[model samples]
Target: MADLIFYTNPQSRGQTVRWMLEEVGAPYDTEILGYGTSMKEEPYLSVNPMGKVPAIRHKGKVVTEVAAICCYLADAFPEARLAPPTSDRADYYRWIFFTSGPIEAAFSNKAAGWEPTPERQRMFGYGNYDLAINTLEKALTGREYIAADHFTAADLFVGANVNFMLAFNLLEPREVFVDYARRMTDRDAYRRAQEIDGRLIAEMQAQQAPQPA
Candidate 1:
């Protein structure tokens, strides 16, 4: 039996865990879900009531949420050194959740064309889209990665987020984000995950084939 089972569809937040699983080097089985399919089914929904992607089952325990799955996988396989020890746990947990919380909120707002005014931005807590980008830019300005000058799980979450941001042009291709994306994507594990996801996407497209218009 594999040590872990990962449930995700390549199209969703599951891409984040797919990158993480590569980082942790854990042996896992994947049951890809199709739209309006197994994702809302009884068994899968039981695993994640929210019906989210990147859910993991390990040692008979169910774990959902993207950041939690990434953190858990890193901790489970200490050999990967994807996270810092308890000594640096403060920074570690802080940014992982930060990326998931404020970053996501701001991104969602932007995607929905809900740009916040200065006061609204402050109330929103992500410090507006520009500040959010600036905050991340400042962090990556000279640092190769997030955390205490080492590549850790925090970087995986934060870095991948920047990449996603750039994908939608939510973030300008500034030097900092670009450099960070370059650094993050250069990782072998990330490259592997990209390859797998690419192939899976291609197969998905192939399955659709062509139809008369």
Candidate 2:
């Protein structure tokens, strides 16, 4: 049995977890679920009640949410050196939660066409899209990594989110965000994960193509 069990779809946020898994070099078994089908059904739902992708089972424990899984894996596999020391975790936790919650919420709300008014923004966890984007840009500007000078799980989460947002036009294409994402995606682990998942995505697309009569 592998040390980890990863459930995801290549098209989902599971891509981020894939990169983190490669970085950790942890032996993992992947169960790729399809959208509008197996993902909303049993078995997979048992592992993640929310029916979300990027959930993992390690050492008889289950973890969901991309950021949570990334952090958990880094700690569970200390040999990966993907986590900063406990003493220097302020930025680590800061960026992870920031991206996971506020940034995520801001972009999601924007995409859904639900712009928050002043009062709504005040009550919002992300405050507003501009604020969230500006905050992230400031945090990443002139810095190679979010947590320490060294790369950590925090970078994986933040970097992946930035990359996706920029590519999908979810976030504005500022130079700071673009440069940071470029640096993070340049990592060997990130490339390896992309290559593997890219292949899987292609395979899934092929399978779903219309069959000739």
Candidate 3:
């Protein structure tokens, strides 16, 4: 058996893991779980009780969640330089957690239709959706990318989040957003993952589309 076991559905955030796997050039086995099927069943839940896709069993350890998986894969395959060295741990920690935390917060709030009034904005850690997005916009504005000043798992995390944000219209399509996503998605590995899942998501949509009566 291979040392790596990937549990994923092509339709979910597992697609990001698929891209990272491609970026790092890791060889592994994949189990494509169907929707509403075995994902919640015994063996599957053993790996991730929440039954979320993109969990990985690697080198006799199990890791769940996208950020954790990205961190793990980056560290596990150091040669890939997907993440920074331990010396850069502080910034690395900040960047990854920012992706999972504040970015998610801004998008989730907007998606919920809970636009914050000035009073409400003070309580929002991200300081309103556009501000949260603008922070990144400024970060990507003058630089080629985020922390490390080179492409790393940090970009993968933040880049994917930005893509999610734009896709949902949670973030306005600023020049920064467009240029950054274009840079990140232009990677061959990223494109390959997109190609694979684009087809799968399309198929799923087709099947679910209302039929002509």
Best by lDDT: 2
Each candidate's lDDT (Cα)? 0.84, 0.91, 0.83
Best by TM-score: 2
lDDT of 3 by residue, 49-126 (tens): 887797999998999989999999999999998987788777677867877877788789779978778887787778
Error of 1 at 4 (Å): 0.4
Q: Which scores greater on TM-score, model 2 or model 3?
A: 2
Q: Which ten residues in a row have the lowest lDDT in candidate 1?
A: 131-140
Estimate the overall C-alpha local distance difference test score of candidate 3.
0.83
**Ranked candidates, highest TM-score first:** 2, 1, 3
lDDT string, candidate 1, 116-152, tens digits:
8876666777878767767767766777667866888
CA lDDT, candidate 3, residue 206:
92
Measured by TM-score, how close is model 1 to the native structure? 0.92
Q: Spell out the clash pairs found in candidate 1.
A: none
lDDT of model 1, residue 10: 83
Candidate 1 structure lDDT? 0.84
TM-score, predicted candidate 2 vs. hidden true structure: 0.97
Work out candidate 3's RMSD over C-alphas: 2.8
